[model samples]
Structure formats: structure tokens, C-alpha cells
Target: QKEVEQDPGPLSVPEGAIVSLNCTYSNSAFQYFMWYRQYSRKGPELLMYTYSSGNKEDGRFTAQVDKSSKYISLFIRDSQPSDSATYLCAILDYGGATNKLIFGTGTLLAVQP
Candidate 1:
């Protein structure tokens, strides 16, 4: 199975709607989880990071992790047109000497105004 899996969705929602993106992983060794947002033809910028199983919230973004189920989710409130972008879920494996990040197939989101 893939270390990390996410549905590469082109999800569309109206402005002010709530958006939820998710990912699943098979590796239990992953200790850090991160969510990144990327615009078309641009690099991704880190939005949130969580260590282990917990929930982290910042502004309109919230990241949740369930280590037992190996599932993670990112929730966005009051979604705006500017929130339209590709969301990537990544996990950091600390098993090796050099920690490496495995990214999921990003999900594209469009908030129509």
C-alpha cells in the first residue's frame, strides 16, 4: 500500500462554504503531519503541522490527526475564492537517519465567488 494516499479531487464549493480535505497513511512510523497549500504553477506553502495524534487550529484552518486510524484531515471554515488551491497532505518518517516526507496526491479545491 502507498505510505500516504489522498483523493486527487477537483472539489468545487461556493464561497463561505466549509471545505474538508483528508488523507490516509499506512506507516505508523510517521511522527509529523503537515498540510500545504499550492497555487497553480507555484510551490506549496506550509499551512499547518501537527506532531502525533492531535488537533491544531489556526484561524480558518484546522488539522486533525488520528494515528490509530492512520487518517488525517484539514478543515477550512468560511472558504473564500482566494482559498482556491491544491491541498497536499504530507507525513514525515523519522525512522531513518534522515527524515523524509511522503506527500499525497494533492486535492484541488475551488471556491467560487
Candidate 2:
């Protein structure tokens, strides 16, 4: 099975709205990192890195993970149209192999002005 699973959202939100994104996994080896991705000139860029369970906040963005439940999330406060993009969740299995990375299909977010 895939190591991580994220919502393939075509989610729309108005300006200043709070946006929530989510993912889930079924691997214990996923204790390493949960990465958030946004589109770049080349392709998907690693936007945020979160470790273990609990929440990590960076400015208007927050990444949360629940190791016990195998759940992960990202929250955006005061959403903006510039934030519109396809976001992906990635997991690294350090316990399994050397840099075995897995990624979700991605969720598309559209913040309307």
C-alpha cells in the first residue's frame, strides 16, 4: 500500500478564510518526516517539513501530525489567491530503506479574492 494518502481537493475558499488540508498513512516507519509540497517552476517543491506527532506552525501555515492515528494535516490562516496551487503530502521511510520517499496524488486549492 502507499505510505501516505491525501485528499485530492479542488477545494475553494474565499479570501481570509481558513483552509484545511489532510492526509493519512498506515506505516510506523513514517516517524521521520511529513513534507508539504507546492508547485514550482520545475515541479513540486518541498514547502514544509514536519516531524513526529503534534503541531508545527510557520507564519500563516501550520503542519500537524498525529502518529497514533496516522493522520496529518495542514492549515492556512487568512487565505490568499496567491496560495492557489496543487499541494502534496510526502513521507520518508528512513526505517525501511535509504531515502524511500512516497507522495500523495495531491490536492488542489483555490483561494478566491
Candidate 3:
């Protein structure tokens, strides 16, 4: 099994709705959890990163991590069409130059106006 698991969802929603994306992991050594948003035909941009357990919020985006449950989530409030994109969850493995990231399959989301 992969270290991280997330549904590859092409989730559709209306504008102004709340959107939720989730991932689960099997690795307990993962210390940094991150969420990235990618627009079509473009590179992914880091949206949020949290260490261990806690919630981080920025405007309409919120990222939550629960190490105890090996679960992580990203919540988008007042979703907009501009928010439509592919969301990826990743776990950071530290090893200096050898450091690597394990990513989920990525969830596609669309918000219609």
C-alpha cells in the first residue's frame, strides 16, 4: 500500500459551497504535511503546510492534520470558480538532499458559478 491515500476525485460543486478534501497515511514518521493546488496545464503551488497535529487557516483555505488518526484534510470556504483545480496532499520525508515527498493521486475539483 502507498504511504498516503487520497481519492482521485473530480469533485464538482456550486460556487459559495464548502469544499473538503482528505488524505490518509500509513507512515508515522512523516512530520510535515502539505497541500498544493494546481491549475490546469500549470505547476502546483503550495497552499498550506503543517507539522504534526494542528490546523492552519488562510482566508478561505484551512488545512488540518491529525497524526493520531493518520488523517489530513483541507477545507475551502466560500468556494469560487477560481478555486477549481487539482489538490494534492503530500508528506515530507527529511533527509537533507535526499529528502523526498510522497504525494497522493490528487483530487480534481470544480466550482461552478
Candidate 4:
């Protein structure tokens, strides 16, 4: 039998609701991090964040970043089932001349209608 240490979640919430998702990192060497929304099990992209300690809002979404705490959060308002997917917390480390991006295990969310 394969060992399962941790399981990804299916965090279910109702449609038209508000939700907050948080992630924490232990690495201080990371240059920055971003929140990626993945759909249909496809690979997530880097068309996301540029971080600083504060809240950034656009439309129905808000991102909270705290460098000292190594914490970040994504808040969504007026959620929909169409938004169901895996959310990943990613950090890019530009060490030396090479750029390395690391990803969290990802948390799957399902917004129920």
C-alpha cells in the first residue's frame, strides 16, 4: 500500500458566497509568491501575483500578503460552481542565474450550486 501523509481537500462552499483561502510558507529565501487557479487538472500558470505586505483587491477578489508572517490569502466574493478548481500557492526563487518555482500541494475547492 502506498503511504498517504496528507490529503488534498475538496473544500465545498455554496454559490454566491464569500470565502477566504490562506497559505503559509516556511522559506524566507523565496523572492515572491503567487496564487494560481487551476482548472480541469491543467497546469497552472504564472499570470498572477507581484507581492507586498498589504491587501490588493480587484473586482470580486482580494489578495492579502504578509512577508514577515510568510502568509498569503485569497478572498473571493460571489462564488460560483464554475470557479471549482485547485488553488495553489507558489513561490519563485531566483537563486543565482536560474529561476526555480515551487508549488504547494494544492487545495481543491468545489463551489456547490
Say which candidate scores most in TM-score.
Answer: 1
User: 1-113, model 4: which lDDT tens digit per residue?
Assistant: 21111135768999999977777777666556677888885888543575657777777778777879777777889999887888877777666797866677777889999
Give lDDT tens digits, candidate 3, residues 21-102. 9999998978999999999999989999999899999999999999999999999999999999999999998866758888
lDDT by residue for model 1 (1-113), tens: 99999999999999999999999999887889999999999999999999999999999999999999999999999999999999999998777497777899999999999
State TM-scores per candidate: 0.97, 0.89, 0.96, 0.83
User: Tens digits of per-residue lDDT for model 2 on 20-64?
Assistant: 999899887677555555755547777788878888888999989
Candidates sorted by lDDT, descending order? 1, 3, 2, 4
For every candidate, C-alpha RMSD to the true structure in Å: 0.8, 1.7, 1.0, 4.3
Model 2, residue 9: C-alpha shift (Å): 1.4
Candidate 2 regions with alpha-carbon error over 4 angstroms: none
TM-score, candidate number 3: 0.96
Model 1's alpha-carbon lDDT is: 0.96
- Which window of 10 residues has the lowest lDDT sum in candidate 4? 1-10
Show where candidate 1 strays beyond 4 Å: none
